[model samples]
Target: MTKIRALSEADLPAVGEIYAHYVTATAATFDETPPGLQEWRAKAEGIARAGLPFLVAEVDGEVAGYAYVAQYRPKPAYRHTLEDTIYLAPGRTGRGLGRLLLGELIAKLSGTRARTLVAVIADSGDPASARLHTAFGFEEAGRLKAVGFKHGRWIDTVLLQLDLTK
Candidate 1:
């Protein structure tokens, strides 16, 4: 069974481990190095302070994935816009876990102060992330070509957006 809940301090290590794999093996994220606990701590704190959620997915009691949103930009004028991020443990994709996490995220944020939820998907030749986001009603807002360099090649980013007010 899969469960979704608020992320806790105990889950940060697992979260880091999950993200590290992507950093080293794929361009799913632009981060070249896995952030330390302090960075993770700061991230959680920042999201919490913004009155948003840092959520985790537990599969049979194991921290299998996490999802969260942060302000799309630092300006107060953009406070109502957030960018969504979701990641799963190695060998944990294609089993509907991303759907669960994203569904819960959208459900939780609907009709709130968040007027928009954005997804910045790295175009690493894998369409999984884009497919997943579009399946959730996220529309293609834009794309930036060659904005990220990883795994010995240039990478583009596909921007998708969901209107929370809808």
Candidate 2:
């Protein structure tokens, strides 16, 4: 059975490993280099300190995926808007883990002051991510063409948003 819960500091290593796979092997993230443990821990701590949700999905005591929400922008005017990030382990896709993690994150955000949730998918080829966001009520907001170059190919970012006030 898979379970979703708050991300703990002890989970950072596995979380970092899961993310490193995407950073190095896929266009899911535009990060050219995988962040180190210290950097990853700091990011998680900062997000938690800001009173946001950082979640993880564990299968039989192993971290299979993780998700979190962060302020859409640092400006005060954007306080009510949060952006989401979700990642699953390399062999963990197509098993509904991403959906579970994201669904729970969205549910948790609904109880907070955040009024909007944004998902900035890094590549147009990622239809599964787009479909997952859409299934959770996120709509296509815009698309930025060739906004990133990774692995010798130009990539497009698709923006999707979900209104929590509804």
Q: Please report, in order, the local distance difference test score of every candidate based on alpha carbons.
A: 0.92, 0.92
lDDT string, candidate 2, 1-166, tens digits? 8899999889999999999999999988999899999998899989988999999999999999999999998999999999999999988999999899988988887668999999999874769999899988899999999999999999999999999999
TM-score of 2: 0.97
Q: Can you write out model 1's per-residue Cα lDDT over 78-144, one digit (the tens) per residue?
A: 9899999999999899999899999988888876789999999999988989999999999999999
For each candidate, give its TM-score against the true structure.
Answer: 0.97, 0.97
Summed over model 2, clashes come to 0
Pick out the ten consecutive residues of candidate 1 with the lowest summed lDDT.
Answer: 104-113
The C-alpha stretches of model 2 lying farther than 4 A from their native spots are none
lDDT score of residue 73 within candidate 2: 89
CA-RMSD of model 2? 0.9
lDDT of 1: 0.92
